[model samples]
Target: MRRRPATPLLLSATLVTLAATLALGSTPGAAAPGTQSAGTQSVGAQSSGARLSSTPAGAGTDPDEALAAARTALGLGDGAQSRGPGQPVGEGNEATMALRDLRVALPQLGAEQRREGEALLARPTDGGDDPVGQGYDSRSKKLCSGNVCVHYVTKGADRPDSQKWVRKTLQVMNKVWDFETGTLGYRKPVSDRSLPQGKNGGNGKFDVYLKELSGQRLYGYCAPEYLVKGNKRLANGYCVLDDDFAKAEYGRKPLDTLRVTAAHEFFHAIQFNYDYREDRWLLESTATWVEERFADDVNDNRQYLPVGQVRVPDEPLDIFSTTFGRHYGNWAWWEFLTQKYGGGIVRSVWKQAGQFKGAGRDYSTKALTKVLAAKGGFSRNYARFAAVNNNPAAFYPEGASWPSAARIANLKLSKDATRKSQATTVDHMSAQNVDVTPAAELKDKAWTLRLTLDGPAAATKPMAAVLVQNKKGAWDERLLEFNRKGRARLSVPFSARRVDAVTVSLVNTSTSFDCWEDQAYSCAGIADHDAAPFEVTAKVFKDK
Candidate 1:
């Protein structure tokens, strides 16, 4: 769950973890003040909202203030937060993070609020002081297998209507553990044995608790229990899942919802064994991608495609959206990498970001660019990916089911005519697609389309890709090089009979970020090279 609009928190560096399905909140394309080189048009229907109930009595609860409250709730303090009953989130994947943060921030909360936080952090089953919230159901049942112990209620609103669901959940989890760990080769979630026998499955088996989570509009979430001593990241953790994913509420068969959520939340547990403080974007996009690897049949995650990179190419790949944003929608990113380089590439990224002894200990983007260096460089591949989104139906194997990327500018070039566009600004790690159609007059075989782009300095990593589609719908792609001055030119067939359209995808591949300033993006900081401007000109002429 990614950070949904309102309703929760993100445990900061000293205690980072994840929730599986928090919807995002934000003015779709708004950049933080001073975080961008320029600004962008706010596109799409997504906007930010603060749950009135989740806001404390006296907190400044406007859109901006709520975002700050959320960030502060995330432990990224923008301003001092007044303590009351720990502010509870309305809905989101921030459930676990807020749950955990509430535990730590309890000292500053009022009596009633502190009690509320304590109750949520309570363990559901019998174990000394194990991870709980399920409450001790006298009829609580336990199912242990392979490397997990699942606790569920036998009766009550929290119980799965049948024991069959329990067995199925465990079976699915074992399958997930095998594929993600044994097959994919990720580190196992660290055991909680230090917590004492039976408490938090101290015997070494990871634990999963079942409860009615749909009430909160969440699928599932995981929480870190302890960090590697001296390191502020989790080495041990546990997860909680919806008892039954009722179709009426979740819009999926109970099993279908269970399959995707289990795969998703458990991966967060697996991540705990690595580094808990990895970038939210990477943490989420990759986790969402793995669900495909484990349960390709479900396809439940496709709902996110509309808000993802293919449809909203303007949003940077690494942005950790404040509300129901693209982290989940952006699964296509990892899908692109794994499909092209095989799943092992994703594992390699984790290894680089992992904080365990001998792990690379790098942050998310750094680990990503480094791993990509061996595969023809990061900017090259990223630009290619953005351009590919322009005509997703042709590029992605499942492209037919995906939406095409947005176009920044559209033009039809006639014989001996030229069109110069106003400067279009794009965000860091984002792209702008310009489509040019050859007019009827340019149908002659010898015609050529001349293209030029002016952008920020090469240090900003401005680059472009020319995608030429022929009448037969065959597509050809080529990368354009921008010199140190950030200007580049290319020419391609402009014959209407031979060419359908040419799309020039202008990309700002800059990865520069202001680290630890607590902005909701990679490095928890804003972009140092965002909203850079670019201008493209297209012309058509006939060769004698």
Candidate 2:
């Protein structure tokens, strides 16, 4: 579940700032959900009035003129715009705020404050006999059954309705938990007998709080407790929800929102039993992804697809920022895993991640790669996953996959004289497309295009490929291999007299590095970094 930003409470105000910004008719930076943006468009779909004939209908024409017209028709200008500093771009709304809370606030809290926060998470402030301080009326009831116990505040006409909705949602949550645990083969956290047990006793029952939260856009979140020493195990985590926000957001069918949120937030509780401090991207992405399995009709996670696909498609999945799009967009990675391998693969990743006592952000990726290598390494699977993302609807062919390829806005690149090349950045499990034309001096002559990639040096480097169309309209792909310095230079030889346009794309193949010499032993070392953007340079010159 995503966290809400800390701000002054405004109960009387309409908290539709995020909803309004996400509405269909919003402006460029604030476009509606699933709408295409400038840089993250679909490769299969061409813009209106852009004529990209598959058949070299006019092959052998002057390459310079043809490329220029193609750029103009596609609405690509001189393309001198900077991709900006390596900051996580966000929609500046509740989701972004939630990311900020997790990425910034949680880490910045002092030792005492962090302990207090964790304590608050383990034992939430129950609204009892103090409405103002607790943020809800003192009247409350605990509904316990199966593996869940819902503590809801009963007040006015909303209490009865809230209780009924929560009861029903718990049934769904339990069913999902049972199925996931059975299929994934994960052990439910052993109940902590020393802690104060609820009505159900120390049976490992998770807690849920339904109350009127302070912030209007608070929604819901999961607060997981870490594993401790002695006879105590990891405390069963709790979930807090803003009932009023759920009602306002869902209108006549507010329970639908509550039901999905319950499934999503409760998964976070389950994840805590594994590794509470796992990578934020993996935590949120898997939590968001599980919502679909329990409640497909309530696509609350869909609101974030375009945020990642259209806004920053090049940003990789392992990016360590609070950008709402990048983190939420990570759901696609899990979806791909479930489809290609099976849901068990996801469980294996979590199981492996939980084994590490103080594993950092790279733990999730390392675990994932380790689990996936048996089928094939992360590099191989990542290449296929990246391709599927470009046009998910076409690749998935399933009814429930996150519709990313249908929505991502295509990236446009133009020749840059200042940089002495056309350049752009690509993220992990993602790709970027650049449109290139030969210089005027080399028109009608044979020339060589040198493509260079500069980025982190991993055991398995990212893949770069050049795609060009032949006279028969077929796209021939040329894969670029890297040298020892982690730089890949591909010399694309072409006759300016024949070829008209060329598209070069850089793809992130692996996100984490493994230091283990053998599978039987623990890793000697691990080098994990966020999905940092890498530069791709395209330089054109006369063939020697």
lDDT of all the models against the reference? 0.68, 0.48
* RMSD in angstroms between candidate 1 and the native structure over all alpha carbons: 12.9
* lDDT score for candidate 1 against the true structure: 0.68
Q: In candidate 2, which residue pairs get closer than 3 Å at backbone N, Cα or C atoms, i.e. clash?
A: 3-98, 40-408, 40-409, 40-410, 41-408, 41-409, 41-410, 316-428
State the local distance difference test value for candidate 2: 0.48
Q: What is the lDDT, from 0 to 100, of the residue 515 in candidate 2?
A: 38
Candidate 1 backbone overlaps, count: 19
Q: What digit string (tens of lDDT, one per residue) describes model 1 on residues 1-544?
A: 1111222322222222233442322222221221110111010011122311211211211233333343443233454232223232222445444443342343355554434434444455542233223354455668999877788877776888778888888988888888888899887776553333434443456788888666555677776544343333444567888887777667768888888888888898787667655667777888889898888888877878788898899888887664666888899988888878999999999998876557777778888999999999899999999988887787667888888898867788775555546468989988989889978767679998888889999988888999999989889999987899989998887888899999889999888877766566766667888889899888777767
lDDT of 2 by residue, 294-374 (tens): 676777677767655323456665554442446776676787788887777787787667632342223566778788879
Model 1 misplaced regions, further than 4 Å: 1-93, 96-119, 126-139
TM-score quality measure for candidate 1: 0.80
Clash totals for all candidate models: 19, 8
